[model samples]
Structures are given as structure tokens and as C-alpha cells.
Target: MIETHSSSLKTDQMFINLGPQHPSTHGVLRLGITLDGEVIVKAEPDVGYLHRGTEKLCEVRGYHHCVVVTDRWDYVSAMTNNLVFCLAAEKLMGLEIPARANYLRVAMCELNRIASHLLFFGTYGIDIGAFTPFLHAFREREMVLDLFEMVCGARMTYNYIRLGGVMADAPPGWADKTSEFLKYFKTKLREYDDLLSFNPIFLDRTKKVGIITAEQALDWGLSGPNLRGSGVSYDVRKTFPYSIYDKLDFKVCVGEAGSCWDRYYVRMREMAESVKIVEQCLAALPSGDIMAKGVAKIPTPLPGEAYAHVEGARGDLGIYLVSDGTSCPYRLHVRAPSYINLAILQEALVGLRVADMIAVLGSIDIVLGEVDR
Candidate 1:
């Protein structure tokens, strides 16, 4: 480890770098923390290690080509990222997607949400010293990935959603496969609850650790389950009502106290809600053009700016595009929920034991791809 003197600190505080390779970091995230013995005096996050300059990459590429780059923002929920980017591009071009395509987007996005949450649940369990739950959660998540592969040709980094609609419609038996997975998912979630949720060990480790009040969370611009876990009922789907979200029936899971457990329970309950949304979307799926009409028209539109956001697995995934009446966007920006959500770590981890660090970070459900992008 390389130690550098900071001009911004008092000499009395023991400044330590907690990560860049620590197990609880989730990825290549480095935390510069000040320690007052076992308690953290203060914490400062050192980001940019994982920066890939995805936004800058967008400036040089056409609107259609940028969708693939969005997939890398949050690798776990590539579909959700695709949906946000495509929606924003469509808005800019003033394109109208088919009703069937809208329903498909909802179904795929909700399924991906559950899959992303399952990854967090698994990784959180491993971080908290329970390996079995991680495996169990992943086992279920793999089923969802299989569904993705069936619909899209690839699993991760799927640029499935196109400028006007999805790359393709659901394959044969897609609904049946998804329905079966959901059924098994319901049972597995119960097993997970019994295995981890009420366990004394988990509760003891997570209950009061990394506690952040609702006000602090809001002040920090936290979104998705992290904000909702803090007693906020604000959901992008409920508030913004994009795509088919307004037509779907689902509940936003919230927590009373913004602790690690609150975040965990919020995600746990959210899986059920996502499952509910998927079922409704699948059942109501109309048979029509899954791909939009006039997609081959090259998407050349009048220059304008548009922003579209979706309630992704993590939180609100937003895309901002400025068009110059050309094939490419003059400016493109993404509101990465993970990047913002991870900002609370320093505030949340202060005074907590090193052991609790992983639990807190995992509870936040951050994707390093988004954080570093």
C-alpha cells in the first residue's frame, strides 16, 4: 500500500485506506477512512478507479450505437439500462413503439430487476459470512439469466432493447419458462427468508449497522430501494409512470428505519413485487409487433434534448440525450443510481466495525460498472 500525506486532514485522526481490493468493496472501490480506534472517525470515498468514460464514448457514436455502451453502465441489469437508453432515444426521435413492445419492455425490465436484486442478496450473504444464501440466491438468478439468453442472444452485456423496440420478440415457450421460473422463485425466496432473514446472526450483524436516517438519505439524492428502505414511498415507476409501468399493478417496498436490515428487507420484499409485475405483464401481453414500425428509417429526427428514466433494479436509471438533428447525439448523460447510492457509504460506515462494512455495502446493492462509469 502506498501512503500519501493529505493537506486536508488533522494529524490526530488515523487515516487509513480500507479498499481498492477489500472483499466487501463489491468491486474495485477504494475507501479512504479515518479511524478512531475500532470506530471510524470519518470516511472518504476514492472513486475513478473503475472509470471507463462511457459518457464521452457516446459523443462520438451515433444514437443507435450508444445503446450498447449503456449496457455496460450496470452490467447486472443490462436490459434495464438498454430500456432507459432506447426510451430516451425514442423520445428524441418522437418515435412511437408498439403496445406489445411496451409490455415486453416492462416484463423484461421487471425480470431483470429481480435478477439484479438476487445478485445483491447473494453477494450480501457472502459478505456477511453466510455462503449458502449467496448460492441459493444465485441459483434462482441463473434461471432468470436463462430466460434472458432465450430472448436475447447473449446473457450479460445484452443490448436487447433497440431504438424503437426490442431486438426481437420473446421466443417460443418464453412465457411458460418465465412463469415456471417465477413459481420456483417464490419457493426459493421463502427458503431464503427462513435461511437468512430472521436469523439472529444476520440481524445482529445488520440491524443497527450503517444506519442512515430518511432525511440524510434524501439529502444525498439516494434512490430506488436504498431511499425506499428509509421510509420514502417514492418510486420512479409510481411517480414518473413510464412505459407500461402505469398500467402494471405492483407495490413499492419500504422500510421504517434506514439500516442495513431495512435495505435488506426492502430488496427482499421487492423481489415478490417484481415477480407480481412480471406475472401481470406476461398475462396481459398482447400479440402485436414486438419491433416498432419504420425502424429501418435510420432514426434521423429534428435536433432536440430528451430525458427518460426507468425504475431499474437498483433505482432510477436515467438517460439524457441532446440531438443536433443528426444521427448522433451531441451530448449524452446517464443518472447512474449505483454511483449515487454508493456515495452514502462514507456517511453510513462511520463508527461501524470493519465486519459490518460488507453488510452495509452489500445492502446498498451497488454495481461497480455504474459506479466507475
Candidate 2:
């Protein structure tokens, strides 16, 4: 009483593997994709190629020593990554960072957000065959990196933020230079729109392609530009309001289009809002101690678990740590936004063309470092 079917029941759809090494993928992400001709039918992401047991590694290290490991997870937003970990530890230890330190943290994390988004702008443009935006975005990104370097001494793998406060104060004139860069960044954003945002070819390539509705996005736990593109106004900064975000005034950019263009616009506008926040932090920057007391020693809170998250450039970068009254954490878990965002690629790709698939993936702006680790 069983129904059986032979090869005749199989559809004509064929599976195509997109990158453990492909140009547009931006890193080592392999998609076992099923295609109905040029349209994607299913996409199964094959990850863990870059996993190095970061959580396990953090457990073996001292509480103050895992900052470097956090840096590698979302290297583009390394400061934000460090902030999340530090905040979690701070919360557990009942530490109160100074107003100056809080504002500095906000400013640095905003700068990190801008730089991270610029990288997204660059790579997304590259994926869609617009070579110029990548260069322009990188140019702006370099300025932010320079400012960060002056403050922290390291560029990409910056373990700048630490528990209780930052590693150091902003070097004098850093604010002025940062303000100058912000002005340049605004002008570059306009240039980007003129160059590619509304280009007929770019529009044709993105609009109505790789569409994901608001309901579908929410159902799949999408966040950041991906969720905002579908018209959701949720921002972790507004929702959670940590590190004096409550004191700052900024708008959360959302798009109604639910397409690649909408996602692109959401991020572009977000950069401008971040500029506003940075300018505020710079103008009202308090002059005082950078590092808080009792931070030099490894802190061990009472045995418990706490979760702290930040509105990272990509999405909510959450750190969950468990303490057992020791200098070393009993357990550590990172809720990497890129990893969660990538989970919805199969749904996003279901009816899209191969080229649009790349565009959609690029628009999602994944960092393989975060995804696999």
C-alpha cells in the first residue's frame, strides 16, 4: 500500500553550487542551490568553513583577554564587537562606566558602523558590476579607519574597547579630523546615489528581483537593513538604548520597497544618521577618565548568565556569558547577525535569477568571518 515513483517524478530543476570560492560571494560561503532554469528554487547554505571554535577559545582565556578573539568575528565592526562583550561583562559585574567613557564608546561604535556600511556599499556595488562605488566607499572607509588608528593604534583588528571603558582617550584634534571626514562622507553619499542608486541598469538589476516581504522577513528573524527594507522600523539602538543611545537623537531609516534598492537605500540613509550621532558625541564629548576603576583586574561577577547586544552595523551583535565566580567565563555565546541573516537566503533566493541571487546576497552584506565563527 505504498506509492512509488521513479526518475520520471523528478523535476528538471538542477542544483548549482555557488562558492566556497566565487567572486561575488565575498568570502568562503557555499550555497547548494537548486535552480529551475535561471530561477533559484532552493538554497542550502553550507557554512563552518571558517569556524575556529571561538566560543571555546574564549572560555580558556581570561575575561579581559578575549577581546582579540571577538575582533575576528566581525572585523569590520570590531569596536562594536568588543563593546558587546565588554558590556555583557560590565553588566554582570555591576560596573558603571563614566559619562565620558559612555559617550566615547558611542562615538567609536558609530564610526565603526559607518565604516562597516561603507564596506557593504563597496562590495554590493562590486557584485552588481559597478566598480566605482567600491573605490569611493573604500576611500571614505579609510578616513574612519585613520581616525580609529589614531585613537587605538590598531586598524582592522582593533581591540580598542575594553571592560568598564575604552583602552584610551581620544587624542586631541581627533574630533576635528573626524568632523572633517563626516562632511566628506555626506558628499560621497550623494555622489554614490548619482553614480549607481538610480541607474537604469542598477535599478533593472535589483528592483522586483530577490524580493522578500515584510511578513516573511519577520518570520525568518531578519534584522538591520534586511528587515528595514521590508518597512520594519525596529532598531536595536532605539529598542535597547544602551551606552547613552537614549541621549542621542537619530532617525531609523526604513524602506518600503522590499527589494535590493530599498536595502541599499536603508543602509545609505543609516550612514547619514550615524553621522548625526557622531557629530553629537563629538560636540558634547566630556573630558575625563577613559578607563574605569576596578577594570585592570579580571572581573568575576556572581554566578549567573547575562545577555548584552548592540546595534552593530550589520544587525544585533549579542554576547551571552555565564559566570561561575571565576576570572574565566563558564560559557560564552555570540549571536552573530550575519549568520542569522544568511539563514534566510534560501527563502530570499527561491524565485530569483542567478545574478539577482548574488545581488541579494551582497545586499544582505554578510561577513563570512562572523557567519562561520
- Best candidate, TM-score-wise? 2
Q: Cα-based RMSD of the predictions, in order?
A: 4.8, 4.2
Pairs in clash, predicted candidate 2 = none
Across 1-373, the per-residue lDDT of candidate 1 in tens digits comes to 9988776545566778877988788888888887765667787888888899999998888778888899888999898899999988888777889988988888888888898888888888888889998888888888899999999978799888888888899999999999999998898889889999999999999998788899999999999999998999999999999988888888888998899999999999999999999999889999989787777455666888999998888888888889888777888888999989988886888788766776788898888899888
Write down the lDDT that model 1 would get: 0.87
Which ranges in model 1 have alpha carbons more than 4 Å from their true place? 1-12
Give stretches of model 2 more than 4 Å off: 1-11
User: Which digits, one per residue and each the tens of the lDDT, describe model 2 over residues 1-373?
Assistant: 9998685565688988988998888789999999886878889989998999999999988888988899999888899999999999888888889989999999999999999999988888889998998888888888899999999998898898888888889888988899998888888889988988888999998887777799988898888888999899999999998889999999999999789889988998999999999999989998888888876476767999999998998888899999998888899999999999999987888877888888898999899999988
Per-candidate Cα lDDT values, in order, are 0.87, 0.89
How many angstroms is residue 163 displaced in model 1 relative to the true structure, after the best TM-score fit? 1.0
lDDT of 1 at 82: 91
Worst 10 residues of 2 by lDDT: 292-301
Residue 304 local lDDT, model 1? 88
